[model samples]
Target: MACSGCYSVNFMAVSSNPNKPLTSSTLLTSKLSSSYSQIPFSSLNFNSKLSRIQLHKSNTAPNSFVVVSGIKAEPLKVMISGAPASGKGTQCELITKKYDLVHIAAGDLLRAEVAAGTENGRRAKECMEKGQLVPDEIVVTMVKERLSQPDSQEKGWLLDGYPRSSSQATALKGFGFEPHIFILLDVPEEILVERVVGRRLDPVTGKIYHLKYSPPETEEIAARLTQRFDDTEEKVKLRLLTHNKNVEAVLSMYEDVTVRVDGSLSKEDVYTKIDTVLRNVLGQRQAAIVLLVFPCDMFGISTA
Candidate 1:
């Protein structure tokens, strides 16, 4: 076992008589004593800025001071885009937990501003009430404010369904909120349409269910299911068409750092692929072991 503080450094013993080769401990103690005062401890890699120097004598051939520098990686800034029913919500939940990031849904933020009745919220409400899309500047302002918050600054953020248009993309850059990576969850158009059409929402519980993929556990809950007006086949088809036309343009804008994931697969499989990419971007070693110790021996767990 190697001590965290110090390890043996072995160099080949040089001597004509193999039987009486120079011993490392004897040579080091005698030769290094005077030189030690001139040798700056700060220059060696001991994993710490202030390392406690210790010399270990081992029977092994080669041993030297080992330094393990702790790496604190930069926070993640991610953007996710997908059509409705592409499972961005589910995947975002997994990503937030795994990476310790904040999830910011652009649509949710707009609604929240409206709910708060702020000046910008009132303007957004006027447009929404008239069935007109809110101006790009208004949405961008809200996003800019949200991203500047202390929580977002500290934990980083995963932006969802933002910069839907080219102008909005420019606004994002102006605000200095460029995403490190853009993840596009791509599903077949037919599959997206099928998922949307079969989806049902529980008005009371706000729980969503899919008649085909996932139905209510009991008939009683089934009775409470309601299909959203937007989930109608005609409306869903229109939405899909619009997404198809614009999604490529948005994706191309971030092609340099974009990663496309197949959302048509099982949710777990999709997430596995996503997790692998995230680990690479975050500079995590896949083979490294993480040991977590709890108080009083209550728990001792290791993860890789």
Candidate 2:
């Protein structure tokens, strides 16, 4: 059955005999409601007083979930950290596409709030216009609401631009959330500035391009590239300063669980290194295995 836009399959078989009542060889095909509260049963066969019951599924199920003899499932949690212009967004896009992990970007949330004319967005815009920081509670509240959504359950998630302060980190812990891995993208300040200043956004599609690193094909289209007001060198420098100070403080508060990657490298190279780090952290055979288990294919889902 499909729940939260994803399909899942579950089945159970029961026998009345106490000994040799159920075995793996017992064949069963039954249709069951997806809800956990409802239990579905098929005809049962037993040799002795029902001692045990077993469940089995055919290969035709779209998403097969079998309960082992004795094992528990754990939720996957991950956090992504980087300074401005460090290509965190680009890398996150790749990771989310490769693995179904939900990508929650703080900056995108703030931008969307401001665009939507919400009270929080209005306050944030005022703070931005005055060159002041938005209050932490507002940001944290937004993030908490986003995480509480039903879609975040079971699947893995990649959180970006959150826990900007050690206080926020402590708050997250109090809320019963801890990241399994924390990734830091280490890019040189000069290179980051260059990348930021050269960047342009297509107003229609919101596609970002860089004049030096990823230019458009035609000169006419390239000429149409528009630079963001905040992408100026001065703004980038200020953002970098604030980010370094905040991130350093936050990192110091947490235990040693960070893996730093040089963001100045090519996109593919960075992805390779990140994939390796995630595999090691998650103890998965490959990054694709993690992705297949965490699929985040929804749009307009608040990553706040």
What are the candidates' C-alpha RMSDs? 13.2, 13.9
Among residues 3 or more apart in sequence or in different chains, the pairs in candidate 1 whose N, CA or C atoms overlap within 3 Å are 8-63, 8-64, 9-63, 9-64, 10-62, 10-63, 45-67
Instruction: Give me the candidate number with maximum TM-score.
Output: 2
Error of 1 at 50 (Å): 18
- Per-prediction tally of clashes: 7, 13
Compared with the true structure, model 1 gives a TM-score of 0.63
* Candidate 1 lDDT tens digits, 3-75: 3432322321111111133433322221221222112222322221333223332222123221122222346
lDDT of 2 by residue, 1-304 (tens): 2323222223222322112233444433333223121111222232223233343321233233222121123445678888778998899999888777888887778878998999999988776544345688778777777766666655767888778878888887888777878888999999998998899987667788888888877776776788876788887787777777788888876558888889999999999999988778667422322101111122112211
Tell me the TM-score of model 2: 0.68
Query: Each candidate's lDDT (Cα)?
Result: 0.66, 0.65
lDDT, model 1:
0.66
